[model samples]
Target chain A: MKYSPALQGLIEALRCLPGVGPKSAQRMALHLLERDREGAVELSQRLQVAVDRIGHCVQCRNLTELEVCEICADTRRDAATICVVETPADVLAVEQSGSYRGRYFVLMGHLSPIDGIGPEDLGLDRFERRVAEEGVAEVILATNPTVEGEATAYYLSDALRSRGVKVSRIAHGVPLGGELEYVDGSTLAHAFSGRRPLE
Target chain B: MKYSPALQGLIEALRCLPGVGPKSAQRMALHLLERDREGAVELSQRLQVAVDRIGHCVQCRNLTELEVCEICADTRRDAATICVVETPADVLAVEQSGSYRGRYFVLMGHLSPIDGIGPEDLGLDRFERRVAEEGVAEVILATNPTVEGEATAYYLSDALRSRGVKVSRIAHGVPLGGELEYVDGSTLAHAFSGRRPLE
Candidate 1:
């Protein structure tokens, strides 16, 4: 079917979202096409504004509007501690739980040699430099529990270890309130190996 | 937690999409915040462009830039045969099957008395006048099989029958290749009641 150039263009742009396949993209496009033209236009406008105005904080690579993100600039947060994560989404997840009060260092992505993404790709060099220059006492690896995430954690850990920064990897395997019978074998094994002494 | 005005403005706008709850909206907002400025600005530009450029076709209510939709203007299509539908998405479903050569009349929505959306609200007035004047030979009721959809079809049928125009509803019950055991009881009942004479 011959769709208007504007509709086609809009759908193509919307396809960038995660899990929005062609059919869903088309539906969204048509929905936008139908009711709320003004709202749709506003949404499209905001997409550009957001992508333009938002940038990585120079200190931690977290999303920010200024030279330093709020977390890095805030005096209430512990400047000596840094929770390193793989993406901005992870930062939100951590923030949602409201447990941590320290600053963060976003890796942007994890190491995957097959995809040609390695240590250098994730701003580890900058992190190492930060550790050397800043009086950072501890670095927490909050990367995902996936294999690639674990691998990236180890790489960062070893790199920061020589610089005299205390490094710790976040625990993996077995979620809270999960049934023992439903737990996978691989996760069970990892939990056994990573067991820590209850102080 | 407090957020920058620019960041929050963009995020607030993005929360309008379907299924995008507050937390997901935050992540999306933060994601866009961190990306290059060029993308967000470009998205804003596109939004206005799309809204201004796309409007409803006069004939079918489908999204279009021109006075009449492409489907309405197609010479090969049976203009005398009209397929009545509820929404733009439903129009696409019929189009994808590629079986019908008839043009369409999109109601934009179905008649729902409980929601205060009546015949006039669904553009049935325009449909009635168009069928009468357009030399329309047949009106195919291709609306969904839901209660509202059925009510809409019956309403349109009764309203148009007095004009002596041939109005037929699409067959209900039993999808092609659907297993009998898995079919719902209501659908099976519909199939049995509406069973045609076996050749």
Candidate 2:
């Protein structure tokens, strides 16, 4: 159907979002125009503000308005330990868990050779320099358990080990509250192989 | 977690979209910041442009950059037959069906006394005037099947009938390609009651 030029432009722009199709784009456009004009204006202004101000933390590559992220700037966090993660979302997940008190090193993405993403692309050189210069004692590998994550973890382990830092991978086990029967075979195998003796 | 001010604002703004919660808003914000910066800029620009340029069509209340919507301004459509719908989205749906060559009258919303939406709120007075002035022969009620939709349809039917105009409600029956067994009881009942005789 032929929508007005402005409405059509709005719909096309909305389609850029993840999982949003043409129908959803149309619905969103109409809803914004009809009922939530103020909210749409706020969203547009915020989008511009976020794009202009939010940038990667110089210290850990996490999102921040300043030079370094809050976590990296805080003196309370364990400066000697760094958790390596794939994305800023992963940092949020680990923070929500409230179990990890160390700083994070966000890779932004894992090593994807097919996508031409290598160690240089992930700022691994900067990470290595920080580990050595900051006297980090331990490096935690918290990348996803996928093939790419595993490869990146291995590479980071080797790179950090040369700097005299201990490297550890987060345990691969059935998630807390998850039944053993529902756990996939590969995860169960990893859990079994990495089993610790009952204290 | 404590996000940067701009990032937090962006996430909050994203939550204004229908069905988008905090988690999805966060994901969208990060995705736009990390992967699709250009698309985010485009979306923001288009949103501003749409809000600035688009307005309700003077005649049909559908979205338009001009004074009247394209469908309403088209000369080929049957101006005597007006399809009354609850929203601009509904107008698009009818247009896409390709069967209806009639012009549309968008109500923007249905009547709901609880929400303080009365006849005047939906521009019913304007609709009445248009029917008489334009020499409208038929008014097709294409409102949704919800209770409010039914009430609005009934209200319009009565209002138009007093002005000596023919009013017809869109049929409520089993949808095309729907199997009788899988159809809901209410829909099956509607189909049974509205069944047509074989020629």
Interface RMSD, per-candidate values to 1 decimal: 2.7, 0.9
lDDT of 1: 0.81
Question: How large is the C-alpha RMSD of every model relative to the true structure?
Answer: 2.6, 1.4
- Model 2 interface CAPRI class: high
Query: Candidate 1 regions off by >4 Å?
Result: A196-199, B2-8, B23-46
In Å, what is the interface RMSD of model 1? 2.7
lDDT of 2 by residue, A1-199 (tens): 7788889999999988887899888888989999899999999999999999889899999888999789988999899899999998899889989999989999999999999999999999988998999899999999999999999999999998988899999999989999999999999999999999999
Docking level of model 1: medium
Tens-digit lDDT track of model 1 for A1-199 = 6467777777777655544577777777776666567668678766765565667788888766788987788899988999999877787778878999999999888899999987777888878998889889999999888889989988989999999999998877789998879999998998899888999
List residue ranges in candidate 2 displaced over 4 A: none
